[model samples]
Target: MRRLALAAALALSLSPLTAGAASAQTARATASRGLTPAEVGTWITGLGGRVGPVQTENGLTFFTVTNAGLTWAVFFYGCEAGVCGEVQFSAVVPGAGATLDKVNAWNRDNRYLKAFHTAAETPTATVQYDVVVLSGEGVAQLADPLAVWLQLLPKFAGEMGYVAP
Candidate 1:
């Protein structure tokens, strides 16, 4: 919980993330913060953190996670076209493995999304997408972000149940 704040604070400190900058930067370290390994897992499931796939009216990529009677979410914000996307994954609440499967499921069915996994050391999952920068989500007529989200999801599922720094 507190660690997440510290981690986010530290991560945020690395760069000036005002509305100006677009695209996610390196995953800068932040001491030991956020949810615990197990809790983080649950949070991924939709309990206390942002987990499940979500498309806002404003067109932002927002998802949720659940844990211990809590609901959390992650907001993948800021970007457009093939340009810079202010990559920001924020856990709404610090819970447990609450939205992992949901995220995995969404990734499996999505089309535009692409899940990137490294066989080496700590296998990580990332999505390659093109979004509409203005709204910060998906467009009603355009299916770019939705498609990308679907594409880069299954790969992440293969590495499901992941938890670490």
Candidate 2:
């Protein structure tokens, strides 16, 4: 009887019915909500990046993400009352040895990630990804973009012959 009770409890814990209801509750609670600039800043800090104070211009919000010798400008999009659906992560390549050729090469080989030079003197490498902001997994989904940024930051720096400080 004890064994049967244990088995029943385990089954209930793993039941799809219970799991679906829990997820549904979570989705409802966060459905209208989206990612926020403050959350991104906190997340960047958690990733060992030095985050500067967040700033807003017009409807866009952004902050600085510094890791080792690399610094990035992270921006949020689709924000309404602090919520956002997407993020753009960018790092400016140092101007001393930067070239548009390298930027073009990166863009040619990469899919979602790219490198470009604006009218600004420094070349910039960037990655942007959309977040699922109206689902139970919305917040967790942010790891997707962050993971890409983490993976690319060092590699891109190396490609540019940058020595991390």
Candidate 3:
């Protein structure tokens, strides 16, 4: 009788219906939601990046981010109240050796980032990558793109012949 009871308990624990219910409960407990600036800032700090004070301009929010000795701005867009749906990582360097051709080459060779040269008297090379944060996406989803940005920024600077000052 003891062996039979143990077998019955094991069968119930391994049953598909019980497993499905447990999965549903776990999913509900860890579901993703809209992103906020605090969450993003904390995530950046967790990844060893320095996040600057939040600022607002033209009704949009942005802040400075520094990681791996490279500094950039992270702009939040499509914001409602304090939540944002998208972020753009941007950096600009003096256009000393940067050319339209070089910018074009970078764009062609890169997957997630785009580069452009400004036509100002003191020209500049700018690179930007945009990531969309959807309602159903989690921290891992957002962090992956930020990680890629952090990894690629220095490479992009070198490609543009940017000498840090």
lDDT of 2 by residue, 87-151 (tens): 77877666444566766776787666667654355544443433445534555666776787778
> Which candidate, 1 or 2, would have the higher TM-score against the true structure?
2
Q: Lowest summed-lDDT stretch of 10 residues in model 2?
A: 123-132
User: Can you give the TM-score per candidate against the true fold?
Assistant: 0.25, 0.68, 0.74
Q: RMSDs, each prediction?
A: 20.3, 9.2, 8.0
Give residue 115's error in model 3 in angstroms: 1.5
Q: Could you give candidate 3's per-residue lDDT for residues 63-120 as a string of tens digits? A: 8888767789888887776777788889986756777778889998888988898867
Position 108, candidate 2: lDDT: 80
lDDT of 1 by residue, 51-76 (tens): 45454557665545443343333454
TM-score of 3: 0.74
In TM-score terms, candidate 2 sits at 0.68
Tell me the lDDT of candidate 1.
0.40
- Select the stronger candidate by TM-score from 1 and 3: 3
| Candidate 3 deviant stretches above 4 angstroms | 1-33
Q: Model 2, clash count?
A: 0
